[model samples]
Target: MARDLRFEPHDQPAGGWGSVRSLFRHATNAHSWSRAVPVLPKQNKPGGFMCVSCAWAKPAEPHSFEFCENGAKATFWELTTDRVETGFFADHTVSDLLGWSDHALEAEGRLTRPMRYHAPTDTYVVVSWKEAFDDIGARLKAFEPDRVVFYASGRASLETSYMYQLFARLYGTNNLPDSSNMCHETTSKALPESIGVPVGTVRLDEFDATDCILSFGQNVGSNAPRMLHPLQRAAERGVPIVVFNPLRERGWETFINPQAPGEMITREPTDLASQYHQVRAGGDIAVLMGMCKVLVDRDDEAREAGAPRVLDVDFIQEHTHGFEDFISRVRASRWDEIERASGLSRQAIEAAATTYLNARRVIAIYGMGLTQHRRGVDSIQMLINLLLLRGNIGRHGAGILPVRGHSNVQGQRTVGIADEPHLVPLDRLAAQYHFEPPRNKGLNTVEACEGIIAGTVDAFIGLGGNFVRAIPDRARMEPAWRRLKLAVHVATKLNRSHLITAETTYVLPCLGRLEVDEQATGPQIVTMEDSTACIHASRGVAPPAGPHLLSEPKIVAELAKATLPSNSRVPWDDWVADYGRIRDAIEETFPEDFKDMNRRMGTPGGFPRPLAARERRWNTDTGRANFKCPSSLNASFDADDDPAVMRLLTLRSNDQFNTTVYGYDDRFRGIHGSRMVLMMNADDIIRLGLTRGGMATLTTVADDGVSRRMDGFTIVEYNIPHGCCGAYYPECNALIPLSHYAEGSKTPAAKSVPVRVSAQP
Candidate 1:
């Protein structure tokens, strides 16, 4: 538990001595200070391991310390000396462990041995590796492949992800759902349709040449604090940085670089965002359209005045399609509708457009803020439309950047962790492995949860992550999880998902990040892909917590061997002995994307995977950059016209990453001790007849027959727009229904939940 739980104003700028102090405290909490000291300098280095946090690209020339506060916390949390061995599990039953908080369960430390659930005892008992593998194989053999679900998290290495997907495919099921389905699948779906690229186009070095940056819906200070260094540097260069979010994030407000001795001595900070607009949640499309409208209006004026054209007429005429229709749609969009839907004045939108037009080389960036909406795919497409108008894609120092979570999250998708069959190379995989892969479309995260609830999914094999806890509608998903006949989890630590056991459950312990992984061919180094599609190698630094722990590659190989027949197409044992064999296989499978991957693994800053969009090559059906405009600018804005409903947007604490809660304190937001607090505008608080610092209950206003409730949340006054509220995620996730998700992508609309808050009895 946190030392103290309280709320107070945080007046200091982000990432100065405050981050250093926080890192020191967290370092001490990693079992001890000395335990975390040795690995601090090695993180994000060439020969060292990648930080198991955000997917922010590593600079070619990294600083002395490449880690940020979030990275440090992740390092400490992973390397903690505390161990949850067989004795610990023996002492606590599954029912007893279910009552523990997420932070408390993780604080018990790493898992040291494989365990199997004993049904009568209601506790987990130690199981041999061979026994667990054989049983899981036999159980999987008994069920139809469609009844099984293979789930992976973003923390998985690209090699392991490739093997996992291959194993699932060879087993006659393409039911490969991963963490990306919930976060950046919208980007994956939208970008390719618009610009014929599935990933962002900007490189890390382009930041220096970028004259202006436009960011949306990302809370950098909490999710990716290391990004502030670049933002601070950009500000120092007098580059204009603009932001649009529902809340005024501290990272956008100001930042004091901890590495800069001058700033530390003077106690001064650099203002990051030159113009910060607090746009309403689910209003990204409206705001982006509003900006495009302003640009179009400016272009009309310029045409009348005979001055310079505001839009790139030649570029659009040559490289783009559907411009006239997109322009007509933007022109038809009324200012009153945009202003009302975006919770901003028309003048504010115009001012932001002026900033956009003033700069030649611009980069538009976003996070889950633009996604996780009813129209998430449309929202991202709208952003692409604005970028296309100015010909931002493939331009020097200008492109789109989607800040992804998890170190290799984007890499996982690149390596075949996807539900869509076309996104993965079927023929090449079949040719490489000498086996036919599953061709049918598989279930996504939400669909998998639905299948589990309906008893269609009888078995679940998780390579990593707490799937049951990370999804929406926990109240409904938990019981359905237990209904499964076989449940398997490959994890590093104990989590709630492990406690909700199936009739036959196995918890397999694997090596954590940076832990030494010795295989038949010396210590193995795994490769991971960053947000910018840069692929780099990561090697282990720390010793394994226990001898029983196996590397993910080894565990995956053994499982693959155990599941398949005596004569299998894959040489699982050989691949496990040397991960290089797997890389060679990947090279053959993806000749263009990972061309000569094995030889290039030793590059100084690693190598970039080929991206045709970076050179403005269109891979779309039309052979040109396509434009799309939604009929309405609002995303779930008119979801419910009920006057009592307020938009509930879930967020993460500064001390937290993804579903893992490191501490109760939210450093940037100034809340401590607990996560059960709802942030609301003062006027909305009064309108709802709620008092600041008082308790309230939130009930979802979903069309689904089921009801969701989040009870006893402390009310705190915030500067968010009216009719919108914010709450900490994984806790407030209870208030979101599984059915309420982005339409095309099926990504959980966790950021735009509609709920009503009232006084708690």
Candidate 2:
């Protein structure tokens, strides 16, 4: 073995001195004392900017220190004193910059000026916004609306997303795909049909009352740090927190609050996850369905004996559909398959079900672990099926919580950043703007990649994300993405997406979330919708990174003005001048969702958007929640053809959030100085003839002719399920085929990629 990988496990609890040390270290890395010091107090508080990280709900009564360790890292990473100018880009060619890693590129700091690719020299040069907008608009006019895709990240606020989507729809394309399509689109897809809502129904306050929590495929410590507070509290109250994941994550073990003086003094950690079952990758459906089957059997037993029924018979009969058929199918399912798939015995499932039956309210939480699979949609629906057996949905302290990453992913989707024409209110949008909107269905993330590869899509307008890097099939995306006729990115910092330039590509500098955005109407506040359905205001505290930087709303408005020939009906300048007018328009268009958005945004914690599930009112075509069953309980890909074939899942480092790699050291996992190490079960290491610290190369086990492989990954034995392994994201995205996606939602199956790992060549 050429490389010697360290295998030191972190024995300390999550979020203690470890988090405190990491916070200061990250701050120092970003030179936070120079800019972030002042804004630290203002983050997640009233009249302050939101953290541009995970969308964990801010408590109504926040602690003195409102932000989490990683949240501060995100803020500091944004508020860095470093700046990139025209000379920097002039010195580096596209090919030269492509050699740098994602972390190293972001480490160069924020982009200071608008830039356009000079294809002759293969470098970017300073360009005036007026000329850039005019030229881009002219070029875009040459292509059909359907050929251009308007992509967004979760960093964009509601106002920015709304204006951006409005501009795209008016320009005659419904091709508005955002980050949510890649992350939690399964939640949006499953919940709407299963519970008659796209988002979960539980409020932040109601979470305090939950007696039990069943977490699936989510890591609370890294992805959503603030969430550890509630989970810690629940643990202390004797809540049975059960976790079903491929790996025994550090977050599922223990957490010590850095903010708690007693804990900091005593060094005692709260034990979390009373029962942690290491379910196999892509086995979430089987495990969840097994729990549901146990509940059904218990209910029947109680009914036959004339005892109290285990199931919520009344709620199921009144609010849901397909119960009888679903139960029958579940009962018909084989136990051997369930155990083989979930990696848990029949007794384990029954025990988990017993804990569920004992609790009055339960909150089922999940993340990409469940959603990024071929059966992602089915996995999520099965989660709903588990909750439905005991009437978990639409109750206080009980509901499905698909914890989202990034600050405003759900907010962007809520404001019409969707590819589906029916999902967006095209009529209301056109009626408000005095233009007939296009009703054609557009491309999602996968479809956009297909469009780019098939040479059907020629242009891409990206708003605040590294779209090219975030999606699956990077081997194809990078080359195909570079061939675009025109690509425009509205961003604050330099990302790999900008480097993969199109024939005519522009990187437009924009204000970060913490930066003051002064406009014709003075300073403006943008709103973001968190996972809890609360739409709150974010007021920036720091000055703009550069004088030339524009707010997202202004960038979109200017683009709209230049692209659409200055229509009086649209009034792009008017909306940018006063953001309140945008809120008024949003209220006018979706009167039910945002009844008093303008009035509520100014209030103390803002207000919750109306969710039909929260009020137990089904909004489906049949006006009822639905129970669904998968074609088969075996959710995993067939790996019997090769003994070396194992399910591979992509993981986020402790330092990174999504594609943004803050640092190479994954502190929670005890990983240092590397992100390309593979986590595997010890037994698998022995069975595959691989030693600890050995180098292994992973190749995709797909039927496609294309051989996707990544080499020279250091192996580290860990507590993962048998026949399953783990690797870092975007880097490992090469192994995931673009064609491999959820059956319905089309989300990339990142969690359960079948791969053959052999000794590195």
Off by over 4 Å in 2: 1-5
How large is the C-alpha RMSD of every model relative to the true structure? 1.4, 1.3
What's the number of clashes in each of the models? 1, 0
- Cα TM-score of candidate 2: 0.98
lDDT of 2 by residue, 1-761 (tens): 23434457888889999998988888888776789977898888887878899898987788888899889999999999888866897688988999999999998898988899998999999989899889988898888999999999888989998898889988999998888889888888888888888887877877679999999989888999899888888889899899988877888899899999999999988999899888889888888878888888888899999999999989999999999899988999888888988888989988888898899899999999988888888888998888888888888999999899989998888888888988888778877778888887888988999999999999999998898888888888888887889999998789899989898999999999898888898898899998888888998899888898888998999888778856677777788999989988888877887888877885555588888887789988778889988876656676756668998999998989899989877877888888789999999999999988888999998887988999989998888888899999989988899988887888888898989999885
Query: Worst 10-residue stretch by lDDT in candidate 2?
Result: 1-10
Which window of 10 residues has the lowest lDDT sum in candidate 1? 1-10
Model 1 misplaced stretches (Cα beyond 4 Å): 1-4, 567-569
Q: What TM-score would every model get versus the actual structure?
A: 0.99, 0.98
Cα lDDT of model 1 by residue, 1-761, tens digit: 12345888787899999998988888777684556678889888888889999989888788899899999899999989899977887789889999999999999999989999998989999999999999999888899998899999989898999999998998889898889988888888888899999899988888888999999999999988888887888889999999999998887899988888999989899999999999999988889999999999999999999999999999899899999999989989999989988999999999999999999889998999988988999999999999999989989799999999989999989889888999988998888778778899999999999999999999999988988889999999888888999999999999989998998999999998778899888999899998889998898888898999998988988888888765455888888899999998888878898998988875656789988888989999899999987767887647546768899999999989998998877878888888888899999989889988888989998776897887878888988988899998888777778888888888999888989899898
